[model samples]
Target: MNRRPLPQIVLGVVIVVVGVVGLLRAMGLVDLSLDDLFSTWWPLAIILVGLAALVAAPRAWIGPTLIVTVGLLFQLDNLDLLDVAVGELLWPLVIIFVGLSLLTNLGTRGTDDRTINSAVIWWGSARRTTSQQFEGGSLSAIMGGIEVDLRQAGLADGAEISVFTFWGGVEIKVPPTWRVQVSGLPVLGGWENKTVPPADPEAPVLTVHVTAIMGGVEIKAGD
Candidate 1:
């Protein structure tokens, strides 16, 4: 019969302990705050587990363990630790980690396919005679696309609108009567505006400034 090495046995024991503890915590039998665990003991745990894994399965787990250890170290707020561990080494470490993860998962794909291709669509319109105002927020639209229609909305002065897209497009349609000023490079495509009516001095002003990379963008008047 083959005997497992000491390091492998230790890793197995540690993993079993961690799994039991996590299960207990999830079932409310243990009263441990995830935040405290992650901010305090988790880093040390990660380091120890990583070291043990490196010794037991150097070919399989060394890279992942190192990546977790480094990430945990970076999340710590200690300036001294950051200065020593990061300093000029931050970008290089990030590049190496990303490259290795990509290489390791080269053949594995579609684990998060649904989230990768998700989008958001919104529609709102009002008559110009109404005193109602239109308001919108982009916090929910992060990392995805958002389509907003305000052409017929009876926009009031001081109406608030914010668009935040991390890596996708944002399309806003408004009456051409409103004055517009954009101050950001949105992908390679240019902004599109259609002719409508003269600007209403009392009408709310529409301001849109979006920042993105490699994401196509288009904005025009919505009828």
Candidate 2:
């Protein structure tokens, strides 16, 4: 069973609620200030975005977990519930996260594994997978970028890659013989597929499920 992404479901509900609220306000049935409400609860949106990333790509958890943590801190501070200043502590945390990611090879590295799990945070990564049996993988870019070349890889049956990009970008290069299917929810972001499928009806298919928040994802055929 294919379930809808949590982020997409939450977004739809939020949009409906907002529309209903706006209608009620216009009808004079309710008195409310959306600007003030948003100002107070804006951090929740960040938290949800992080959650969306986390859910979309669970293998790449560090970056999304950091995002959620930061969002929580901001939310607490916004409500005057935190003693320390978030701005003062965020830079050091960012440094630590970057260091950890680099050390773990999750931030940047080349892999020939059939299944790849990669996450890049606050930095850039370039990976070329040469796996003969290319399987699905999870890739994430948080305040960073990742370029993955799968042109030399071969897909067994059909493969699916899950991606999450928050304030970052992801570029994927595949062979022209593969059939590309790109589908996902983009929150203030977008994704594009530029791969040309071969004429064979049974051509290998590559399905990409992406959640982009204020970022972009591009899949194209390699030269």
Q: Per-residue lDDT tens digits of candidate 2, residues 58-138? A: 655666777888999999998999999999889988887777666556432455667766677877977788887888787
Candidate 1 global CA lDDT score? 0.45
* Candidate 2: pairs in clash: none
lDDT per residue for candidate 1 within 73-182, as digits (tens), equals 65563324454555456567656644553453344123221111112313221112122454433211223455555555555554433333324455666666665544
The TM-score obtained by model 1 is: 0.36
Error of 2 at 23 (Å): 3.4
Off by over 4 Å in 1: 1-131, 139-143, 185-204
- Find the candidate with the highest TM-score and give its number: 2
Error of 1 at 7 (Å): 50
Q: What is the model-wide C-alpha lDDT for candidate 2?
A: 0.82
Instruction: State candidate 2's TM-score.
Output: 0.83
In order, how many clashes per candidate? Answer: 0, 0
Question: Considering summed lDDT, which 10 consecutive residues are worst modelled in model 2?
Answer: 102-111
